[model samples]
Target: MLLAGCAGAPPAPAERPAAEPAPPPVAAVPGVGVEERDWLPPLFSGVEDEAHYYISRLPDRRFVTTYGGEEHPRPWYIAAERLGQIGEPAIPLLAARLESSDEYELMLALYALMLASQDPSLMAATGGDTLELGSVLDPRHNAENLALARAWWQRQGWRWE
Candidate 1:
């Protein structure tokens, strides 16, 4: 009789399906492509705001160097360093800028991403060994770098926390 009661009792609740992993986060800015004019500069007034200031100045290509170890006056380099110092908080912003059509903006964003994440893979993917101002400026190198960057972002950007 107890066995019959046990049989009559409802089967244990079906095991809940495992929760799906959450989708990766997207960039704050919507458009995947760049705009006609530089969009990042107007976000901040000046140096008073560190992140915005650096982000705004990232496209400035006034001075650049052939290699990393050597010092350069490029505002983009300084901005990349500053943004790197800002760390994870800067990832999404830099990620957004990766969509930029402007080569400088895109490259600067990639450089900042390399710094902010400190991921050797990103460095490796984006030509860390050959990276330089000239390589960034060269059309062939730029396309290669951009392709690698976009691929990296697709694969790892969302999971980069």
Candidate 2:
């Protein structure tokens, strides 16, 4: 006769807990379909609205300070300054402006993009080899600038956060 401990067959294997489901895939564009406007406080309705206001006012001429100490129109400087300060959050909105037929808007958007991202390559893409604001804003280079800016946006815009 078999011993009491050895008589019974080996016990069945213990059951394992069910495996967890895989997480949902993330969107290629981080904020693709969400209503970003609703998330902000009432003072500023949305980033787009704020960006539009500043972009609409981008100056045709650069602000200059006189030797006598008189400052040029501060509003002009302020608009570009604000856009620059908005940084990456302002990128997609600025990129949308790239398709406009208006050279002013296109240039302003690209300029703001350069300022926002602080990416010298964006300015370089506009054919401005230097970081000087004047070189990037020069209207003489508009066609080449727009073409290159558009190409850059095509390759890199969606990748921005």
Candidate 3:
């Protein structure tokens, strides 16, 4: 059904639609550096915008979370994965996350800190009163993981209790 344009006066001047301005193009991230879109910020600047977004956004709702206990692989495993990508920038977040009650999350954070031990700030984080963790670095309890931690410590020239 054709609707008549006004029979009265000249048809209203054909309206010109306003043109949308194009958004500013972003500069590409350097090749040596991590791609901005590829990682959460600092790890990949201008990417995720916030630090630890990768770790934070993981499925914490899972019945088996990264914070240890009966769960075979906790949600914090992803945090551990992202931790390796973050380098020294991940130190503060990992350090802060270490304070949580979840042993899995806390252990993952500690493990990440071990990987990023080159940063001096990590020393202070490791020097805390009591660490919530999966297993201590004592060989008597869990020999394999303890050995791994010991090796990691020796690599970083760090001593943990």
Each prediction's TM-score versus the true structure: 0.47, 0.48, 0.36
Q: On residues 93-138, what C-alpha lDDT tens digit does candidate 1 reach at each position? A: 7777876888777777777766666645545654543222335534
Rank ordering of all candidates by lDDT, starting from the highest: 1, 2, 3
Q: Which stretches of candidate 1 lie over 4 Å from their true place?
A: 1-49, 62-76, 119-140
Best by TM-score: 2
Off by over 4 Å in 2: 1-42, 45-49, 59-68, 71-75, 119-134
Off by over 4 Å in 3: 1-50, 57-76, 118-161
Which model, 1 or 2, shows the larger TM-score?
Answer: 2
lDDT minimum window of 10 residues, candidate 3: 31-40
Find the 10 residues in a row with the least total lDDT in model 2: 31-40
Q: Rate the local accuracy (lDDT) of all candidates.
A: 0.59, 0.58, 0.47
Displacement of residue 32 (Cα, Å) in model 1 is 32
lDDT of 3 by residue, 1-161 (tens): 99978778876888999999999976464422222233324444433343357457432534122344476643434445555455556545555554456544545556655555544455466563222235542223343444454455454433332
**Preferred candidate (lDDT higher): 1 or 2:** 1
